[model samples]
Target chain A: MNVGELIERLNRIGALRYEDWRAWVIEESGNSNPTREDVNAAALAWLKDKADGSIWLDPEEEQMLGEFLENVVPKHFDGSVVDALAFLERYGPEIASKDVADLKTYLNSPTGLAMIEKFNGHTGEQIGEMSHFFQQESNQDLSGYQVLRELEGPESVGNTSGSLLAAVTGIMPQQPDTAASAAPAPEAAHAQSAPPALMA
Target chain B: MQELPLAQTHELELIVDRRNRAVLLHRGPELEDYLWAQFDPEHNGLTLFTEKGEPRNLGLAIPKSFSDKLARASTLKLISVSERLHAGRPRQISLLQTTEAFS
Candidate 1:
C-alpha cells in the first residue's frame, strides 16, 4: 500500500506513538524491529496479516501507515529509539539489549545527541542519500563542483557577502558612541593600554 | 543565498569581520542564546558560506516570545558553505541565518 494507507492502518492499530508502533509491528511480524532492516519485512507481514482475514488494514489504511512511518514517525520518534537501534546495529550484541535509559543518556551528550537528532527524521535510504551527497561533496568531485561554481556569480557573490556581514555582526549597523559613561576615569586607562605599535 | 526565515518579525543581520576571520549572526537582544544556538553550522542547510572565505548570515526572525519553544523542539543551525570571488583571490566565508515561525 501507499504511505497514507499504511499510516492510517498504524493509527487504527493504536500504533500512533513510536514505541507502540514498534511493539505492535515487531510482535505481529515476528521480525526484529531493530532498524530499517526490518521495515520491509514488517510492512509485508502487516499487509499479509491485513489480507489474511485477521486484523484488517485495508489499502487506504496501509498507505497512511507507510506515509506516517516514512515521514512523521521518523520526525517525531523519541531520540532514544533511534540511538538504541543504531547502537545495536553498529556495535552488535554489545548493545543489542541496551536499555532505553542508557541509550537516552548516550543521546544526551553533545555528540551523541547531535547524531541522534540529525538522523531522527531520516530513513536508512534517506541517510544513504545524504551520505552519498557528502561523499561526493567531500571528494570535491568535478560535476558537483561545477554546479556550485555556476551558482556563484557576481550577484550571488554580493548577496553572500551581505549575508556574511549580517550574520557576523548580528545585522545591526554599528552605532556611534554616544551615551555618557558612568565613570570616565577608565577611558584614559583603556586608551593607554591599547597596543602601542598600532597607536604609533 | 537562502532568505532569513525569521526576517519578517525580527530585525536580524549578519556581520563579518574580514580582519578577524570570524562570522557572527545578530538578532535583537531579547532572544536567548540557546535559541540561536539551535542553528547548526555543519550542514550548510541553513547558512551558506562564500567561496572567498566569508560568513553568510541566514535564519528566521520570530518574536522573542517563541524562543523557549524553538530551543525545546528543533535542531536549527547555520549550515552550508558557498564560495565566491573577492578581488583576485578566492575568498572563503561561513554563513549564519535565522529561522522563525509566526504565532
Candidate 2:
C-alpha cells in the first residue's frame, strides 16, 4: 500500500494508525492522495503539533508508524539517500520510542523489495523490472545499500557547516573579522529559549 | 552587567578605556583569557570578534531611548528582558557606557 493507503487501512482498525488523519489532511492540506513527500511533510508538521501539545498521540501508534517508514521507505529524500542512523537521529526526537535500525537480514530480498515497490505504487511492469535489477546485481559481491553508498558518496557525508561545530568539523568556523573561509552556517543557532506556554 | 552565575557562569567583559577604545574579554571555561570587539562610529555599526577574530555583526540596531543611556551611566547591571524588561539596555550599547566600571 502507498502511504495514503497505509494511512487509510491503519485508521480502519485503529491500532498502528493515525485516527482522524484523513480529515486533518483534507481540512488542512486539501490532499486526498498523499504522496511520500506529502507524508514526510505531514510527519514534520505532526511533530511540531505534538510538541505544542495541541494533538494527542498514542505512543504505540507512533512507534508503529516510525517502523513502517523505516522498513518500507527508501532513504531517498529530495533525490538522495542519507545515512540510516543519521536519518533516525534526525527524527528520533519526534519519534521517541522506535529503534529505527533492524538487525534482521534479508528483509529487502527480491520478494520484500517487490512489496516495497507496491507500497511505492509501482506498476507491475516496473516492479518486475526492479526485481530483476535487484537480483541480478545484488547477487554479486555488494548489497544494494553498498551500491547506493558508492553512487551518493558526497551527500551521505552530510558535511553541513558554518557554526562553532564548523571549527570542530574542520569546516573552518566563520571569523567575524576575516574573510569567511566556509559557508555561513546552514541554520541559525538552535533557539535558546523555549516558546512561551499559553492556554488555547 | 550581565551577571554570571557563580557556578556554571562564564564571563564576557567589555571595558571602555579612557581613550574611548573598548575591548571585550572573556575567561573561558578553562579560565583562559581572550580579547573578544570593534565599533565603527562612522556607520554606527558594531561587530563582535569571534575567538579567531572574525567580525560578526547581526545588524542589531539600538533605539535612541536606549542608546542615549550609554553616554552617562557610570555603572549598569543587566538582566534579560524576561527578567527585567522595564530597565533593559541594548547589549551592543553596553560597552559604550561612561568610563568603564570594570576597567
Candidate 3:
C-alpha cells in the first residue's frame, strides 16, 4: 500500500493520536523522531517508491512485514497503522504461529483473494489459548512433582513441593544424638572393684 | 559438582553386556543435563537411560516415590539398578531355535 493510504488506515485505527503524525511516522520508519516537514517528505518518498514498485523486500523484510500485517495490525491498531507499529516493537514475538498460518491460508483462498481489500481482522483470544495449550502439552512432566515430594518429606506433601528437596529430606534426617554418641567413656579400674560372692 | 554451560551439548555413551550381566555408564557434557534430570526427580520430562545408551522415555507420573527409593540408595547400588533395568533380553529368532539358549 502507498504510504499516505497506509498512514490514513493507521489513523482510522486510532494510531495517530496527536495533531502531528510525526511520532507515528518516525516509529514506522524506525528513524529518530523527525519534524512534521521531514515526516511528510519521508512519507511521500515511501509512497512514491511503492507506486513505482521499486521497494523490493528481502526474506527478513518479508517476514517482518508478514508478522506486522498478521499480528501487529489486527491486535494493536484500533484501525490505526501508527499504534500497530508501536505495539509491534514490544509484542511481536508473542504472536501465535497458528494465527499467521491461518492468515496465509485465508489470503490464498479464492473467496479471500476476491475480497483481499477487506481482509483486516484479529484472531483474538483463540490464538492466545491455542498457543498456551500447545506450550503446556509440550512441557508437561513429573520431575517437579518428584522434587517437591522429596523436599516436603514422605508425608505426601502432594504435588506442590520440589521432588529433589523432598528426596533429600527423606534420605537425610538430622542425627539428634550424634554428639553424645561420639564422646568416649573413661574405663573403670576393674582390679580395684571387689568381685561379688557366689550365692549358695 | 561444577555446572556446565547450556551452550554446550554433549553425547553420552553407555555400554551394556547382557551375557556378562555388566553395565558401564559413561558421561560427557551433553549427557550432564539428562543425568541431572534423571537423578534429580524434580526435573520434569526427564528420560531414563538404559546401559545401552537408549533412552527409556517412560513418563513415571509419580517421581516422588521413585525419588524416595533413590534417596536411600547408594551411588553404586543405583548404578547397578540402572544396569539391570537396561540389560538386554534374548531376542527370539526362530520358533525351533529359541534365543533363550544364548542367555
| Number of the top DockQ candidate | 1
Model 1: per-residue Cα lDDT over B35-80, one tens digit each: 1222332222233333333433344222222222222322222222
What DockQ was computed for model 1? 0.04
Q: Judge the docking of candidate 3 as incorrect, acceptable, medium or high.
A: incorrect
Write model 2 residue lDDT over A1-200, tens digit each, in one string: 23333333333432221212322444457874454345445644554454343334355445544554444334322321122222222222333332323311223556534433432335322211223343222222221212211221111001122222211111222222222212222322222232222112
lDDT of 3 by residue, B13-67 (tens): 1111111111112212223212211333344222344334344332323334333
Backbone atom clashes (below 3 Å) for every candidate = 82, 7, 18
* Candidate 1 off by > 4 Å: A1-9, A15-18, A25-33, A52-200, B1-35, B38-103
Candidate 3 error regions (>4 Å): A1-52, A58-79, A96-200, B1-103
Supply candidate 2's per-residue lDDT for A149.
Answer: 19
Q: What share of the true interface contacts does candidate 2 keep?
A: 0.00
lDDT score for candidate 1 against the true structure = 0.30
lDDT of all predictions: 0.30, 0.29, 0.28
Give the Cα error of residue A98 in candidate 1, in Å. Answer: 42
The CA lDDT at A68 in model 1 is 34
TM-score between predicted and true chain B, model 3: 0.25
